[model samples]
Target: MNFPTHIVAVAGLIINDDKKILLVKNPISGWEFPGGQVENGENLIEALKREIEEESGAIANIDSLVGVYSNVQSYMGWDGVSYTPTKVILDFIGRYVGGDLHTSDESIEVGWFEKENVLQIIENENLKDRARDMLEFHGKVIYRVYETKPVYSVKSERYI
Candidate 1:
């Protein structure tokens, strides 16, 4: 018997007291919230905090889960010979606690932006959609199934 394996990641839509959102700019993804794949043996909340700090030089407290998304589309890895694993992403709402904002090796730019301006900074459609869902979150947790390859498309969505 084999245990199912997937690439698990965590992201934070962190808002400061000024209502500004934390954002990071990477070469590949353009602009996005701070997040990355979870390492083995790392707790999800720890991973979220670590990623936020590492990518944006900010300390954030995980407030609540905003959504869970699955990218069913598999793509070729950089190696080109092997396919990457399916991705399961946990998106959370976070409160900015402290620390000066700065960019890390993974991020070329890190700063706070007005909430209304986030969508414009994020160039990836998939991320923009997720940001919309997060920004529109009232009280329910959103669940979405989507594919990204030839084009990004949503297979299904649910408010939980």
Candidate 2:
């Protein structure tokens, strides 16, 4: 028997005491929240925290799950040799607990931005959707399905 696998990833929308949102400037994804693919045996929350620290040098106190997004399209890897798996991203809302802002290999720039300005900062349409949901979270978790190849377009979205 064979089992199907999906690339599961986690991210945190971190807000500091001043109500500024944390963002990382990734070489590949541009200005987006800190997060990455879950490593083997790592729980979602743990992976989110690890990604936040690894990408932005900030410790976060995760508060709640904000949304779950499914990219139902498969795309070529950076090397252009093989197709990548479909991705399901779990996004969480959190508070910046401690640690000064710093950059890492995954993030060339890390800083806090006003919540209202996040959509303007993020270049990717899909990431903007995630950021928008995180900004407007009102005690509901959202589930969205989208495709990215031809253009970023939503297939479906609903509150969960």
Q: What TM-score would each prediction reach against the true structure?
A: 0.96, 0.97
Candidate 1 residue runs with Cα over 4 Å from true position = none
Candidate 2 lDDT, 15-92, residue by residue in tens: 999999999999987999999999999999999999999899899999999999999999998889988889999999
**Model 1 clash pairs?**
none
Top of the candidates by TM-score = 2
Worst 10 residues of 2 by lDDT: 1-10
Q: How many pairs of residues in model 2 come into backbone collision? A: 0
State how far residue 6 of model 1 sits from its true place (Å).
0.4
Candidate 2's C-alpha runs over 4 A off are none
